[model samples]
Target: MHTLRLSDEHLIGLARWATDRMARVERPVLAERVLGVAGHRIQDPRARADVLTAAAEARLGLGHLPRHLTQAYAAELQCADEHHKAGHRKAAAASAAKALILAFHRVAHIDGLTSPLATDPAQFTGPLRRSRVLRALRAPRGRVTASAAPPADRPMRLLLVHSANDNFLPVVLDHYRNHPGVEVRVLDTAADPATAPLAKGLGRMIASGIGIRSAYAGQVEEALRPHLDWADVVFVDWCTAAAAFLTLVDPGTTRVVVRLHSFEVFSYWPHLVDFSRVDDLVFVSEHLRDLAVAALPRLREPDAPATHVLDNAVDLARSPLPKKPDARFTLGLVGLSQVAKDPRWALEVLRVLRRQDKRYRLRLIGDSMEPGVSPALDRYRTAFAAELAPLVASGAVHMTGHTDDIAAELTNVGVILSTSVRESWHLGLVEGAASGAVPVVRDWPFFADRPHGAHSLFPRDWVVSTPAEAAARILAVNESEESWLESGHEASEKAISTWGWGTVAPRFDSLLCARFAEIPAQRRVRTIAE
Candidate 1:
């Protein structure tokens, strides 16, 4: 199952069938459903090239597709990547769609092909043997190297690595950026010229995952060597290509910690990571840790690193300002964009409340849906948009868009809603709660009955299973101005006391500075974010 290869004769036969099928069609379209005689048509130039490249590989009995196909895939991925970096999210999504379509075309019409996703985590086999090369490259544990920890009093050097978004790094960065005892540098592989190839080199990543070393491996080794050398501790933000890239090289003596926030548990990257090289593997929640462990059987091996659950840093010092009497009517949802946020659920709650009281308006804070990320996302966005159109026109909802000053916006919101279907942490609701907004967290369906979810993260009274329950809670709490203020104040006090940085920051400080031996293992991952 690990070797999902199609033989040359098998591939050639499929291609011939597709070719003949295309010849028979009166009108050829680009859609996935528009099959040629065999079952699909290459609609775009990139996909067309893929057909030729795949045919060339089959004809020559080559082990891989031609260079042109790989380059085309990498270039398209980079194009989408640039859009994401520039905050042209919709445009970025559009570009990524093209890349996905081309990738699909690469395997079109073949048996066990047509679907546009990767194999399930359990399907892919990991390292079969630590070949001679692996033995030579691996850095043995507990050995002293040039980057070993410095004396306790010396400035501790830290390098933060990010493969994509860095939204969660602000707390860590702000704390150490100018610390007299620490030197910190951030490297975003998405932007770094040398490391950027590590991200965009689709062919390289594939070849390396299957135990083959290509030029891209040398490029990554060269690019990351200096940064790894300069740091006493390397904290890679996500379990992604950056983490995989780091593990490919033997870190002389630096402590490497990789944090798996949430979605990466379902991605292919975690399987590619060589756990023996990592000293610490962190997760924001326990459920995600469980799923990740289940997906990759290797984590159970003795070589797996020590695991820790670290809460995301939230600056809880910002005290809540007094709210006006009318603030009771405003419900706020802080972040949106991905389909997972499910703003439509929040709108449903708004509808339930406004049936009796029209003043119950919703303030939607964050970016509108970006349809370019995937076809599924685009469909969800379209459906959600249709549902929201009438409400926006009727003034029942206000799309405030994204903002730099979230604290200022929370002032008018008495109720903060977490309507997400899934989340590793719900930072928006907690931030709003720190500002004295009553939190109404949905029982996140992804882990509702499973261990460690919104239900376990917050007080039972703060969580609801449906829009009706959320509406009822809102109605009961906001019956009078006194009742609303009293509820909001209580929620605010609990959020800061339990989850605020005042309580959480010290844990992080201890984590970063403590000797690896001091931190306990298999601890529950906790976050007040959701």
Candidate 2:
């Protein structure tokens, strides 16, 4: 097979062909060609955007993200910045919003060549949003009173705010809701019809740096202000639109706490949050703290909210079940919907294991990737399906998609693999470890070279650089049933002791015990400066 060495001339022709509706079969290869060299070589911004857009379209149609993605993203940011400098506020806002969304999801928008983040330009420039920003910034530091003590007769009021994802909150919410010292109420911004649009609107305003007092903001204030006044300490999960929206209001005496997980760093949402109003900022891991501070400069300022690295609250009691005898040959990977999870890496590990022992099989424990999310994901899904086909057909791969009871599923998962390119803390991997399955964590590439990553996050022996290394580790552990069981037992003990809710919840309790100062701080939790 002769590989065509595509050059600038070939790319130019391909770009023309793309405009004329290139064959579906040629789309992936053309995207690869553009990404490999041609996209970067183009100098003119207009031409670059056009070429990159063509590449994006090709990938969306068939789906390998080429170097064109970064090129397009950079081009869009430059355009937004230039527009802002020229005083084209609306144009700049639109471009900035596009760039912001692009950073999180590859497509600027789905099928419309517009960003889902784009709103009425007037909403950002309107008096409501502008006045809110001005007033908040100009407000005196002493304006927000010290944390209000709960009424002498009542338990301290605690409000938990969440948006779309609440995987981490249910356990915490249940504990606090039942606690004798606290009263808990959950305000799901995503679910409330009155607040959902407001949440999205606030994010848009922050991304554009224009309005914070639009009609949307007013509605959000209407929905949240009452709750803000009622709570002593407010915990906002996922540092997303809802978190940014919280920064729009005066918390008065409420001590606001926000948790930053993995996704927010890659997005512009963190840039929008007013950290000064927040009393505490929580991160699930040390590496995330390192990245968040680097990504959001406000986090580095002296007046920035006190930041802490705390382990996620996980329920490990149900996970320590005895494994089936044949489970030693099965490798499990949970939550495969996100492309960042990189399930293909797990496939590679399985291939390496099967080369030596055909009995080794892979059990995927989550829903397969769904299409129409993004071009990047679609491309990954296309490639993944092709690679997964043969093994699945041969019965070497078993998929148990989207199970509510993972602990029940773990009975057959001898080894649980974390093959993600990035994660703040892989809850699935840790849960599997607690379930008496040996944990194999790929040295997550996104943070592997950083000072803190999978190696620092987990036991050094559990992190591997390659599929071969993972296979070797698995084979060594599964050399016999006794060794595998022993390894799993040790892993289970480590997870339960370190991250289980019983151990981690106290740190949260101490943080929330603003009025009740009886609880002592746990020694393990570290402030960001540390």
Candidate 3:
């Protein structure tokens, strides 16, 4: 037997061949792996030149490639062109650009990639203009204006700003979606190009001499003025980028309510928010409220709006228990994507369970967060992956990525686990409970010692300090499948009846009505005119 150690050129050639083969087989994972290897090989100048030549040859001979693969090759060529341009290698840069243009043309014929690159006049300098990505990502702005008369006798028009894909949005939307006295509009702040870009730009520039009030202040004010004029109340979630943008807009007569979850208080966005614009502040947990108050001095201002603690709404009606005989021994963590969720702790508890009875298995739901976003999260993610790799390989742990139907996923999971270090409210835990999974909370580290923690929110027996304790509780509950099922049934009943959207909707209505009544009718009329 002979072992081969391939040169960079050989590796690049092999990767290209593998990619072509994988694309023919319609295996995205294999194609992705080949692309990764090709990317690594292209780090060497000689190898990169060879790869570009190979790509050009492939284009001429093969005629066309997969859309994704072609795009990847074009991106690699563009990166090579950038490196050449940085080094003033005109010839090399021109070669790379030619290759990129050829690859781009091949893929442009596919659906969703048909925008001609154009030079931006605003960014022109010294007889040259930069070609920005002017494709499908750009959003078309429509004319938005203030409503004429508060939209059908609703006490107020309320805009709730939230992330587009968060699990929390559905719950929040359900609470106020059809409230008679409040017309609620759920604006996905993260997806709004006009406001999101300005907000992000302001955040990056604030560290420099640029005035925090000047960066996106005018843009936000202009974009949101009409909406604010129409809305008598605005609720901004996360007290981070979304809240800061709302404050910058100056809501005029519209009262603003900013909700601070556990993560935002640790970020710089809270400091950037103009507290004077907010009419009220809501926190999911009292400990979060205390932390924000202590961390940000503005919250302590005598004139600051009243702060209230409200639990996150859950549409428990949709969560129904599933049938599984061995479910009593199956411990599940509904969300394991974030470091805050602490999947490793859950793994430790599973280890303890397996020691007692090998029938124990752990299920992890939700995809991991992108590590490029935060250093703290990246470290935690690395450690978690390392811990789970062996357990997963042994078939003791199961991973189900993002799912639309968690209630269905919880069918075989008897014990729901929350090992997070922090939480605004563990919606996953609550939802799991509603699905008939017995809740096992880890006594969130961020507020475990505080007067108001998981201990106050859940039953005493449900909160545990360590994995061993948690494992012991699970074993005791699982001594008999009938008893375990009954306990989970009770938990589900309590969660659905108490935290369901039906009960939470009225509270949202009351808050909006009270805020609207406080606004003078004369000012309301003027707002309508504006």
Candidate 4:
């Protein structure tokens, strides 16, 4: 075996010589490492440049890297600064370019390391010059074109429709409020008291498997027409009674977008939606889209409006609060009023924890879904109440009933728990994480084994398969107060930075813009077919 040895002084001298050589030339390794360390803070140009310079010096010391490798690094630095200025952060885009450059250099294919900025300036340019060029090229020549101006000066109106009042409505409203050049009007199908009596009677008739027209059928049309006439877009949330109402209404020239959360896939409403009238359908997860498409064949038809997966938007700013010192022993469950929430699983976990130490307790929040509404729901509700009653009576579980102030409630919760059988996206658990509660998510059973489900949606370590596993994880987290608080803080930071409204709103804007730009081919094909 060959052996090589160097004295400390010799090694120190060699390091100094390498540092001097790197300072004389531009290298990018150190700059890239620094960029990785700064992470999201690359939004600041000075910080980004510092990172780039450090990486450049490191690469220069390596001595054999290609020139374009350095240029690629510089291009990324410029792109980062430009994107940061444009308010996009562009972290993924910048990182991808850097990776491509490194990959190409490693394979001795430096020419392949071309920067998108150099090759496609129009991609980065505002208002995309190529799109305008294409339109000009496509236009008939010699026809004196009018000035490039909007055909009509009209405020863009949006009709906001939902099945019933819930937590999602306020968040949706907040996203679009104060948006430039748009007017929004909200309509709640379930809250229309004028149709209540008719709905109740129709509900009884529908239960008998008889097809009866809803008393509110005409009313839906009447309520929708004026808004549709004035609106550029109509956004309906949940494929429920509201979707049925919107389908019955003539959209005239307005674009219609419907959002389907997870639970609605199994509901009867999917059968009622008139896809012919819908212009777009939004899903929160790809798994949800797959399930919905499989369950509702209409959605799979080529003529169906475009489908999109847009994650649920969360307001993360309101999540973090000063945590109570005693919160380490506290496990919290928000939105416990539904059987799907499966608070009993949380109770089982609490029981396991109490066996280890009585310091553990579970907090149940949110009103239970009214059992009187459906017999199927009532059966599950009764069983859940029975399981929870003993725990509640023993003071091991505390029920807050329901409160509008979730942030305040979360301050006392150290661990946020989601013990749900199914969910589109558990907003409550995410909100709890935002509130500095260490999230303990139950692997949602409905889609646990499915691709792009809960496991894919959350950090792997945060998810658990059973009550026992969940309890074990909880105990491990609360091993000490300091560890528990640290975990909570980390979870909150992740929630706010990753899923917060500020980060997610742009995605929604992109989806909406794309939806608005596409005229549904279904509408044209259907017109011709008719």
> How well does model 1 score by local distance difference test?
0.66
lDDT of 4 at 75: 39
Task: Provide the clash count, candidate 4.
Answer: 12
Cα deviation of 238, candidate 1, in Å:
1.4
TM-score, candidate number 3:
0.65
Residue 26, model 3: lDDT of 35
lDDT score of residue 485 within candidate 2: 90
User: Model 4, 1-530: lDDT tens per residue?
Assistant: 11135433443343344334445555534533323333223344434443444444454334333333333344344554454345443342343234223322321211111222222222322121222221221121111121121124654666687766455767767667777755678866677664333322222222211122444556555666675666677788887767765665456556678999865654445544666667678898877787777556566566766787777877779778898877888999998666667776888889888998998888888887674644435555677788888888888888888898899999989899988877788889999999989999988876776776779888998999999999889888878878888888889989888888888888766655333333333232133211
User: Which residue runs of candidate 3 sit more than 4 Å off their true CA positions?
Assistant: 1-155, 163-166, 193-197, 203-217, 369-379, 515-530
Lowest summed lDDT across 10 adjacent residues in model 1 is found at 108-117
| Candidate 2 off by > 4 Å | 1-92, 107-153, 202-204, 207-214, 515-530
Q: Give the total clashing residue pairs for model 1.
A: 7
Q: How much lDDT does candidate 3 score?
A: 0.62
The order by descending TM-score is: 2, 1, 3, 4
Task: Candidate 3: give the clashing pairs.
Answer: none
The C-alpha TM-scores of every prediction are 0.73, 0.79, 0.65, 0.64
